[model samples]
Target: MKMLVNVILPIEPFNSMVRDGSVGEIIGRVIDDIKPESIYFSEQDGSRGAVMVVEVPDASAIPSIAEPWFLNFEAHCEFRIAMTPDDLKRANLSKLAEKWNGVHA
Candidate 1:
């Protein structure tokens, strides 16, 4: 079974994580190494916060798999879920947009 996990974390530090490129590198390494299937992060306008979604095989992996990352930020354990199509669609689009550049060779 597949799941969609969500976590909300503080913004400024998260942005700092982005500025130092640790967010990108860390998240990429986590996903590539652990192979969560899908995970994503987003920041809201006018809010000093961000949220992330991580798809895991089951809830069992949450503690060991997530603890390290959780320690790096102020977080809330938002969800453990089975993703819907709309959820997957939004994640896929947002993730692609983050990695995409308008220019094509």
Candidate 2:
């Protein structure tokens, strides 16, 4: 599965916690702390806030894992299931749409 969690962390919190940390350190900590099956930090282009990609084996526990950054507005996540092209080609419209959207973005 693939989850695109877009967080607009308050400036103060970002400064205090994650902004200065090395990518490896932060990714490692997030993995160890949240224990998601796989999580990756993505650097946004010309954007104020950061974005993250998390892959978890199960769909549960996402709320708790995402709770910390729900400070400004709400933490927005676009969740999706991953599949090979052949699999995607055979998917229903709703599923294919999500995958297409991810690719285009």
Candidate 3:
């Protein structure tokens, strides 16, 4: 399955790493390990952040994906399942809606 991994890096260790010029090398190592399908770096909530679309084989793989950031940078990671248009079509949402539309708890 495709997953959106949101990473929020804290300022303390990250700033120190930037000063020592180790940030790039560390980040490169993590990125290489994760091998995301796509990645974007930006600022979020006044903190350094990265958004990555990664292909995860299973739930067990999540820790491997998130632990690197957690251990290396003390970063927060969030994972969300993502689906392509074709995947959405395969869900048959319209049929589900029809079945549930008039029924509510």
Best prediction by TM-score: 3
Per-residue lDDT of 1-105 in model 2, one digit per residue for the tens? 655556543335455455556534653555476655444444444333445566665767676567644532243444455566776667687866777876743
Flag regions of model 3 displaced more than 4 Å.
Answer: none
Candidate 2, residue 59: the lDDT equals 65
lDDT of 1 at 69: 53
List lDDT for all candidates, in order: 0.61, 0.54, 0.96
Best by lDDT: 3
- The per-prediction tally of clashing pairs is 0, 0, 0
Model 1: C-alpha RMSD to truth? Answer: 14.2
Off by over 4 Å in 2: 16-28, 35-48, 71-84, 92-105
Tens digits of per-residue lDDT, candidate 1, 1-105, equal: 454555566675778998887886766665565565555556544444334445555568677556645776655545556668876786878668778858587
**CA RMSD per model (angstroms):** 14.2, 8.2, 0.7
As for candidate 1, its clashing pairs are: none
Show the lowest summed lDDT stretch of 10 residues, model 3. Answer: 96-105
**What TM-score against the true fold does each predicted structure earn?**
0.51, 0.44, 0.97
Candidate 1 TM-score versus the reference: 0.51
